[model samples]
Target: MDDKDLELLRILEENSRLSAQEIGSMTNLIPAEVEARIHALEESRIIRKYTTVINWEKAGNGEVSAIIELKVSPERDFGYDRIAERLSRFRQVRTLRLITGTYDLQLMVSGKNVQEVSRFVSEHVAPMDRIRETATHIVMKSYKENGNTLFEQQEAERLPYSF
Candidate 1:
């Protein structure tokens, strides 16, 4: 991608709600140009989906988040993709990643309460045929829970010969 595309991505990453005109102003491009660039970015899959970053705690939803490590049986025929697909369908699952370590998969989940999360694990996740064992760590407090970042370009300035 060109410099213009990088700038557009930075702006969109900070706030997807920004209008094409607003983005154009920041990047010194025409509104139509900005629109077309954004469209191209989306088509190329560089810009995925525009989504909201909610403040869960402030929303008065006393929910708890957890990271569940799963140890799965090695695939004999089909593959791990099938098991990953099935687990991904769960509404409580925020993010799932296949990792290289003792565990096969890492899952980020959230629920209304501890009991609700426990129920999800005991009733749903554990019973899955491919799963061997599961370990969970509840999120007590978030120092940074995504979307809390400064997008100012100047903030990333590095002095010459600093390194």
Candidate 2:
């Protein structure tokens, strides 16, 4: 990836809705060049997908999210990659990563409520052959997520109420 490619990525990262012309304006490249660069990025799997970060609370979705840590005895040669691939197939799994720490893997899962999350882990995750142990932590509140501030507790805006 060249400097131009990095610049294009940065521009798109801020706001994916920006047109090629808009990005080209910022990077001094022509619209056609910007489009071609973006296409190449997608083909190379560098730019995975364009996504929207929603304030689920403000939207009144009432969905709950949690971070779960897993300890697994990695399979023969396939190792953690095999276990990770199986976990990725589930719809509830939002994010999963293999980390070097006390635990082997950490997962971010979302569901309607705690019960749903518990059920998913107990039913699916716990039963996995390689998985030795699992720990789940439910999110109480989110101040920020995906680089967007959900709420600022310090800057609480109150409406003037008349009795």
Best by lDDT, which number? 2
Tens digits of per-residue lDDT for model 2, 1-163: 9999999888888899999888889999999999999999999999999999888888999999999999999989998999999999999999999998888999999999999999999999999999999989999888788777887458577889999
The per-candidate count of clashes, in order, stands at 0, 0
Candidate 1 wrongly placed segments (more than 4 Å): 76-78, 147-163
Off by over 4 Å in 2: 152-163
lDDT of 1 by residue, 13-122 (tens): 88889998898899999999999999999999999898887767667789999999999996778677888999999999999999988999999999999999999999
**What's the distance in Å from true for residue 41, model 1?**
2.3
**Which residue pairs show collisions in model 2?**
none
Q: lDDT of each structure? A: 0.89, 0.93
Top of the candidates by TM-score: 2
TM-scores, all candidates, are 0.81, 0.90
